[model samples]
Target: MSGSFGGQSAGGAKKARIEIIPLIDVIFFLLATFVLFTLSLDKIQSVPVDLPQATPAARPITEDDLVVLQISEPGTAYWNRELISSTEIPRRLLDYKATVPAPRVLVSGDDKARYGDAVLALDEVRKAGITVSIETAFRATGR
Candidate 1:
């Protein structure tokens, strides 16, 4: 009797083949998951409000109507070019709002001013219901 020492049957050994279908499916699934995650990153949650409509006959605002609120490095606040205390911001904002028909404010600060002082002034302006803008250009002195 002939002896077959190798663990192969009478048929020759089958060739090893790589199955790529499942690998392609797994790669596609990972790509899809990453795409979906990236798409959701920019979702913004915000409250809805009814915005005011503009009129064609509305009067244009002049430079004289602009109010500049400046904050200094020493934690003092300024209304236009006048120095003021921090505690007086809210009262002044409210008074300005009541006096000006279309109140507008420009919040500015010295380059070395405290961030909290500027934010405090901005918060007061918002609470007074006035239109506000920020001054991005910095000056050596608070103005």
Candidate 2:
């Protein structure tokens, strides 16, 4: 078979064209991916804490040893083994001479005790030129 070619004198020439649909689709897909990533942000979680319970120790109280100041739930306070008013703590402590050896104060408060009472007791003990430490009872390991 014989064929006739179009154009000027012999072979034909044409300008190449590029398709834009695929390019446009790729751009849209990237934009959608970025938008989704930005929309789904990270989240955090937290929890509240509860104070721990204390166990009673198997020991006895003695005088001229480590002094323990207990502030009971009813707002009553004790110095060593004696029940004394809050105001009398400083005077009694001051009257105690260095020769008698004033003992370290251990302020023990009830679970439902007021924070102010404990802090005030510590302040008074410090003012009386005495050292202080917090007392905690240890749980028994065996029966």
Candidate 3:
């Protein structure tokens, strides 16, 4: 039998080999899929609507037209220097908007004031459709 156990020819067994082309193709396919998925994450989903066109106003606004809305430490709201209750904010804003051609508000709060009060004032100002700005002064709190 010449040491052939199965009575077959003496051809050696084929060595195991990794096919590089198919491996590379699979890796490139996964990379392309991952890149496309990541790119899609940045898309914003929103409802499309037709917006109104803005017409430029002939008159320009001045510093005197600026309104200051201040919130104090006790959560009290002051409009330009006058103390006003929270319920009065919306009405006052609407009245001011009606009277001024271009309405703008400056929202400020005391260093220790309740943040909710300031946010409420800002929300009312926004509901009134007026432009608003926040005060950014740094004051040292005497601890």
- Residue 14 local lDDT, model 3: 50
Candidate 2 lDDT over residue span 1-143, tens digit each: 23434433334455356889999999999999999998898766768789789766445534565767776544457766566667776776676535455456777775645678778878988888876887665312110
The TM-score values for the models, in the order shown, are 0.58, 0.45, 0.53
TM-score of candidate 3 relative to the true fold: 0.53
Q: Candidate 3: what lDDT?
A: 0.79
**Each prediction's Cα lDDT score?**
0.83, 0.67, 0.79
Give the 10-residue window scoring lowest on summed lDDT in candidate 3.
Answer: 1-10
| Per-residue lDDT of model 3, residues 1-143, tens digit only | 35444434456455457889999999999999999999889777999999999888678778768888887655367787787776888998999999988889988876766888888888989999999999878432221
Better of 1 and 3 by TM-score: 1
> How many residue pairs clash in each candidate at the backbone level?
0, 0, 0
Best by TM-score: 1
lDDT per residue, candidate 1, 1-143, as tens digits?
35443554446565456889999999999999999999889778999999999677378888777899888866587788888888888888888888888899999888768888888888888888998999898765754
Give candidate 3 misplaced runs (Cα > 4 Å). Answer: 1-58, 138-143
